[model samples]
Target: MSKVEIYDTTLRDGTQAENFNLQLEDKLKIAQKLDEIGVDYIEGGWPGSNPKDIHFFSRIKNYHFKKAQIVAFGSTHHPQKIPQTDPNLKTLIEAKTEVVTIFGKSWDLHVKDALRISLERNLEIISDSLAYLRSHVKKLFYDAEHFFDGFKDNPEYALATIKKAIEAGADCIIFCDTNGGTLPFELETIISQVKSKFPNISWGIHAHNDAGTAVANSLMAVHLGATQVQGTINGVGERCGNADLCSIIPALKLKMGIDCVTDEQLAKLTSVSRYITELLNIAHPPYLPYVGRSAFAHKGGVHVSAVKRNPQTYEHIPPQKVGNIRRILISELSGKSTILSKAKEWGIDLESEDPEVQKILQELKDLENQGFQFDVAEESFKLRIYKARGELKKHYFRLLTYRVHDYNTLDGRPIAEAEVWVEVKGRERHAISLGMGPVNALDRALRNALEEFYPRLKEMSLIDYRVRVLPETSGTEAKVRVLIESRDKECVWRTVGVSHDILEASLQALLDSIVYKLFLDERREKC
Candidate 1:
């Protein structure tokens, strides 16, 4: 199999996503996770741009990545500015990265318009910066910014820009589908021409999703002999977004027989992708290939039956390879396989052909036909399954009363005070605490209350938390929804809590987090 390099720009590009940003420490944590997951290159950030990014490279030195090279991303050295004085160029030197990637204009329109520079100066910007950066970093990647449009508009100029970078000793010349509007056929043809024009130059592909064709264009680029792939994990970036590395690396590995990422750590890819999203406080892309929760989930009866008969009948790849598993969801359209699968996932030991399976499926269908959606709330789904088979444990933490105080303030800065009383293991206990936020206060009080009875609860903290407000109406009367995530040293679990009162919604989720931990503990004790 051919080897294609996978460069993940999640920290640089993915952070620009809407409501998605990571602090310097968060970036380092995610960078380490990416390294553990075995990516080739990690684009840390444009150190020339943000203070957090500038601090990231320095602080990240406290740790080292084994399987990935940390790459610093920035624009080409400013036109006519001396390389030493240019902050952009200096940032590259300061970042201390082994690889430095800089982009220059390939399109004349950008030269005359955005840069307001002459055409010849643009070529100088490309080659001169690459040559200078080559003297500094071990590897230099030159992104032909807007290369596809440049090729389509002026093929000669685009080819000239790349040839100039090739002459300057760039390790790779990456074609940028910046607008992401190029069809696969057009992208393949343009790339093939570039390959032929610069036969000796190692080529790369970086595509966007403006037209929702980023993944397809990147795949086509690989098919046409591009040796490197540049993208963000989960397809996050400015505007529409960039190509997704999560999809690209697997497509290169499983689909195209290319070894783009580290070999043995493919299973960690799913958790790595998910961990980045969780740290960024963004939801994982639902349909992301190989890593999404719904990637191989089956809801249709025909699909479930076929999957049971022969997994290849419906699955594209085995789900186990990436720390993920196929989910047969129970819905109105679910079959007995769906029920059987859910039973198994919930640890119930019912025969696949048991008549009770059909009855449970019908029951789930009837419930779903009303307003129940078990797929999103698996805790409740487990409860239903356990109850149907007479396997439910009694409630662990029975809520006695919970209260919220709005008047906890020191010198006028107000914070929430939470008081929670619960019946735990047949004993009544009370806990009270204050926090910067209502949910935090509730979580702290609950954990404090249960520490004596459930000491393991002290080790468990809310590592990744989320809140989703689903608006069904306008203004004040809207029904609000909340989702909270809590994790400890080992694993993570999410609980959904919804109410008109935001405090109540958060409290409900906080309650579920404690109960789920206790429930799992009781199960372990039984085992």
Candidate 2:
């Protein structure tokens, strides 16, 4: 087994992906996180490409990294310009990194068509630029631009480019499948030949996912003798995307017998993945490999039954290893496991031998056939189960009826207010409050009515709100689904409500949010 180095380029290549931008602070935070998690190298950014990265490397200069090296990424000295004269090269030097990676044309077509440079001239550019950097830094890496295609088209010239970089004292050689179209078997064969010719030199592999084979090709190259792997977290990059380090790291360390980081904190894999997503405010990849929400989940009745008998029956690996949990969801296809697991999740005890359990499962099936989704609105699902089991306790203030009145303004002012009437423990209570919208008015009115009883509600607030309007007709009347997101000191959750009346949808959504918060308080008190 070889000691495979993991290089993280999320700050660089990842930003190339549409909408994956990180502020200077975000980049620093992610860098610190990668360092904390024991990545071998954190490629800060392409200093030559933009000002943000240049500012980042300078800002992070004083920050300490215990386990990883910070690398500055850029391209080879412009066409034929002198290395020192090129601002691109100057920025790389100013990045304050011990390691720098520069790319040069590896494919013959890129040379003649893309770069429009003679093959021999491109070779000299790679050699002299690398040699210049070698004098400036102790570590230098050369990216063989379009290397795999270059290998297939003109094997001799591509090897010649590698030889130039090696002779120029490049510390590591990385073959970039810039187009991301290479196949696994082809990558293995090319990497084998590169190894045979350059037996004494260390090399890295950077594959993209255009063909959806970046991960496979990366692993194949590693098996064929490459010692270093480079990719981005969550597979963000230009075009199709770069290899996903989240998948590659575990496959190398846990599955392939090679270890990168010694931090048992590797168990926090999914947490780290989610941490990045939260900062980016992007939806977490549900189908992400190794640590996704669905990675260990079993949904179908047959699969759930088998998995319940033995987790290893369907799961490739234990969910806990990657900081994920097995979730058996309740749906039309759910079996008894759904009832038992969901019951366990809600702290409900339903004996397996109980005959009523079957009836409740059937009821769940029927409710699912209705427009109810239990996955996102877990509180609603729990309430149904409790009611079915004769365990539901009504709120101290159960809502009777509510009316929201909104016009341009009360008296030449833009104001909205709501009136609420509710029977709390059989006593009638009423309240009103002004708000930003009809939903806001309703929420405020309800909360003001219950503020004395459930004062803990004040601790939480609605952070975000989303509405999905579904159109049945091509024109006017469209039904809308409102998904409200609320968060307190602990965390945030989403609950959705749908109706043709937008205000009614908003009201239902607001109710879900309040009930969910109350349930959380109750559960925490019990625990």
Candidate 3:
């Protein structure tokens, strides 16, 4: 099997994305995770550009990585200065990383316009920069920035720039699709031509997603004998982002028969992807390939039925191979197979011929018609099954009454206070709390009233709350659906509610969130 090197640039190029910023601590944590997944290189950041990156390099020295070599990214020496005196080159060495990667102008257009240097001078800097860093670092990589576009405009000059870096003792020459407009076929042709010229030199690929084909171009380069693939986790980078290593790694190992990551390292892929997004406070895109939430999720009745018989009927690869599970979505479109499959997953033994399956199916459709979407809130769907099967015998707590008062103080700050009365184990408990909104007040009040009886509820807190107004009705009278995402130490669950009043809808979802947590704890206790 062919071997491919995975170089992660999430800490560097990925931070260039709009609204995507990371602290020094966050970079170190992500680098540790990348190391755990067995990536070949981790580009920490451009130390010459930012103090946070400088701190990341210094602090990261406290711990050691097992497999990944920390890399410092910079540019070729300034046209006005020699490599030995250039501050950028100085910072790269001072970063004390095992590997150093510097990008140089390969496009004559960039040389004349961006760098304002002659083509010959740009080639000279590329050679001088690599030769200076080659002795300072264990491995040195030359990123021919805009190599594809340069090759298209002037193939001879582009190949000449690469030849300079190779002759200067650079370990690898990475062809960068800096503008990300190169198509896969164009990339394949250009790389093929370059390989013919430099047959014995190691080659790498750094592609962007402007043309929506970064992953394709990276894979094509690897197929054409490029050994190194550079990308970011979840493809987070500037513009449309760089090639997604999340997609590339699985394709190389599971699809392309390349030995990049072991099965154990592959299983950590999904968790690692989500962990970075979570730390960045970004919602994990459910549509991402391989490691996304919906990657292996089956929803259509026909798809679900076929997947139950054989997952290969609808899925290309086993989701478990990438550390993702096959999800059977519940909705009006779900067949009895979907319900039985979900029930089986929840450890409930149910047959296709079970009368309760039809009952649950009808209830699901009826609720969906009432603007209740169980697909995103599977915990609510699970409760529906439990109720249909009479497994949920009694209520954990019953709401007696609730009232919310809203007013503005003299300082012109609006505040809401809620008083909640509930019966737990036949004892009435009442609590009052203030919050930023009426719904928040109600959530706080209710939790305050119940936390004494079930302290485990304190472990669970609402992470995300979304309200959607049903389009069937318009204006202030429209029905609303509330989806609440809650999490404890073990796992996260989403529950949904719908009502004519937004506050009532929020209350219903909140109740389901607490009830689900209580039910899970009770079930675990029984086991």
Candidate 4:
């Protein structure tokens, strides 16, 4: 089998997603990352549509890509304009990318309704557009927009459109599921018909997720001998999103025995998925396949036991193959093997028959019953293990008391103030600080009091804090769970706390965050 080419359109089609905007610097950074991951092409953007994209094309020229070619995307010439003078085609040439992709109307419905041109005129537009750019760009691709729907509506016209493009020197013909309504079987039948007519031509598949079959359809296209796969990282695109290359790339390389990317490049898949989401400031969906946080996590006792003996019992592939780690979740459903696996992961020695394992298991169940979730708070669970083994003997600081106050200014701004008292190594300290909210003020005040005793505490800061109201209660009496994500220069960790009072819950999580940091530092020093 031939190696499939990966064309990443995250900077182009991906930006069309709501709230998925990226600055020029972000695009540049992502382009570098895409090149590092060995994508064949990076669709920069439509330079003619937006000033930002134009600036991106200009700025990207400074960086040298080792593997990927930067691609400029645009549309066919307008019916009223000549291809040589069309602004869209002119801008595609000016972008100076080695490769260019332009979409043309394939569906006769679009020719009549969208373009409002005669059928022959649209075909002329496709032929003229590709011919004009073929000489200017080193490689040209024709995206047959709505190709499958067009084929179903008028097979002859659809075939004619691509026929003109091929004759005009298009290097590849990409069949796009523009409306994302094509299913796997439907795509299979259409592509089979199309390929039989043009077996020698290079074919690619571009799918959308409206029908929730984008990845399935893409794989089907590959199974039928399509040599190129176009998608975005994490599937960020207009509407439901494009096919997720994060899932497709691994499936091709690992499952289908295709060498689309080298092993080292494939291992960077998880981090690249996360890096794009982090830059977009969107929460990465933990349930996403392959690279998601929960993709390889196990919670059932039976499943954990089997996986401990052999990961293949429950997992489809090794989590480390995609730069993801296997997670043993601490929950009521977990058994002794789960605890033992988690302990081994954290470098703690424990036998299967250890009594402390059962003790820790019961403690986890009791705490989870009280709204304390340990699955997302592995640091808190690790602390529990240390306490169970009587290893957490050192107390860095003892909290004496804390208070928070909120006030409204005449200017309509709200102010929060917190005062904290703590005792450390026979010495006492008191500090007060103002912050954006009660939780923020409390975190500041506590750090102010403790940073003097443990200077390294200044290095760690809270990155994310989320509050959830437990459904077991309601109204003002409802219990709240606070999850705090903290990070130092080294790594990030999560801790959880639950209380009827939101402030108390926040403080419990904050305390765990600080203690986890201190514990890590001590462990590192001892090592």
Q: TM-score: which candidate is best? A: 4
| lDDT score for residue 507 of model 3 | 92
Residues 385-407 of candidate 2: C-alpha lDDT, one tens digit per residue: 77677765666457898888877
Order of quality (lDDT): 4, 3, 2, 1
The Cα local distance difference test for each model comes to 0.80, 0.82, 0.92, 0.93
TM-score of each: 0.80, 0.90, 0.95, 0.96
List model 4 lDDT by residue over 1-527, tens digit each: 88799999999999999889899999999999999788999999999899998999999999999899999999999899999779999999999999999999999999999999999999999999999998898999999999999999999999999899999999999999999999999999999899888889998999999999999999999999989999999998999999999999999999999999999999999999999999988889899999999999999999999998899999999998999988899888889988998898888999988899889999989999999999899899999899889999878889999899998989988989999889999999999999989999999998899887789999998989999999998899999999999999888999999999999999999999999999989888331
Q: Is candidate 2 or candidate 4 better by TM-score?
A: 4
* Worst 10 contiguous positions by lDDT, candidate 3: 518-527
Runs in model 2 with CA error above 4 Å?
404-419, 425-441, 463-483, 498-506, 523-527
Ordered by TM-score, highest first, the candidates read 4, 3, 2, 1
Q: After superposition, how far is residue 382 of candidate 1 from its true place, in Å?
A: 2.0
Instruction: Write down the TM-score for model 3.
Output: 0.95
**lDDT tens digits, residue span 1-527, model 1:** 36787888889888777777787788888888888867789899999998988898888777877878989999888876966678898888889999999999999889999999998988887877888888898999989999999988899998899889989999888999888788898887887787777777788899999998999998988887788888987888889999987788777777888766555677788888888877766678778888999999888888988898899998888987777888887667877777777777767898977776766777777755544455665664565576677666576677799887777456888798989898888899999999877778888888788888789887677755555555456666655566666666665766656666777767766777777777666676321
| RMSD, one per candidate, in order | 4.5, 3.2, 2.0, 1.7
Error of 2 at 287 (Å): 1.6
Model 4 ranges off by over 4 Å? 525-527
